[model samples]
Target: MIVRCLEIIHPDGDYPVAEFDGIRVGGVYPVLEMVTDDDHCYIRVLGPDSPDPGLEWDPVSFETVDTRIPPGWTLAIAGGRTRLADARWQRPGFWTDYYRGDPQARADYDHVKSELLAAAPPREN
Candidate 1:
């Protein structure tokens, strides 16, 4: 299944509508649009077992893992794969662009998911 993305409005606002495969699967963001705001928020996509027929807003859960790039590699947005190459990291801000850097592949949803998964500080084990 293709992992789609949607914009997450904040300050308690409605999430933009999302569409995939011409199917109006329930979502809280738009398929393609400029996202504004810098609240360290998230852009979520529903899973297969999403609560359909109901839009009950609820906090999502995730897993965590100790991970980070080698300070030079970049993330593959389309596939969530990382490759060692010269990459320019962008500053924290409202990111409207789907991908990072020139010749952008796609937005780094995997990276975002990773961050969310590890939102809690990692424990040395």
Candidate 2:
């Protein structure tokens, strides 16, 4: 089952999207996404979920985390095997482009994906 990303759209009018590894959220900030067995998700801030400079915590939403978080948002994943903090998830389907940095591997993967797509049956409604 394909789950959806918890797209955090701020009510501050800007509606800035955020990530775990973001400067104001992750990395030095360490605002990590914690997922539960019932498919519930929340944050487990390590030290401080530092709110971004010039941005005040929206009333009735701010948590103890230091980083400026958009209330609660989905951390999209299946089985939680992979991670949202990883850069790879940020650029979906860009693996080919990334491996293009290693010419031989890129060519191999592209050919494989093409062959697989060609062989796979078409989806039906």
Candidate 3:
């Protein structure tokens, strides 16, 4: 699906983002991936300064921090794939490296996220 959104700064919409299943996405935060099935959408979010350990998304709200990374939080809303790709590419650093598809980025992010998830509290289900 095409990632379209009215920017608050500039209401006119822009590029489409990609999802976890490999579609496009767009948002304030760089969306590494997204999952939209049924009426719900789940996105793998990354932060600017931190690893952005995963979150337990209940399809509506996020209550669990799956990764060891603290100060982690989920933005419940999402947009089309790669919607922010162009804008993101223009400015890069930290977790944004992964969003740009840097080969080592996935490994580096996975390593950190995995360790955090392991150390994190167990999930309810």
State the lDDT at 74 in candidate 2. Answer: 32
Note the residue pairs that clash in candidate 1. Answer: none
In order, the Cα lDDT scores of the candidates are 0.29, 0.33, 0.36
Q: Which residue ranges in model 2 land beyond 4 Å of their true spot?
A: 1-100
Cα lDDT tens digits, model 2, 24-121, are 32222233333344544443332223232112222222233233322222354555433333222223443455444655445544453333334333
Q: TM-score for each prediction?
A: 0.19, 0.23, 0.30
Q: For candidate 1, lDDT tens digit of each residue in 46-114?
A: 332333211222222112132333333343332232222214323332134433332332345434433
Best candidate according to TM-score: 3
What does each candidate score in C-alpha RMSD? 13.2, 16.2, 13.9
Report, for all candidates in order, the number of backbone clashes: 0, 7, 26
Candidate 3 residue-wise lDDT, 4-123, digit = tens:
212222113443323322111232233333445455556454433323443212223222233222323222323332222222222335357777777666676666455434444432
lDDT top scorer:
3
**Lowest summed-lDDT stretch of 10 residues in model 2?**
52-61
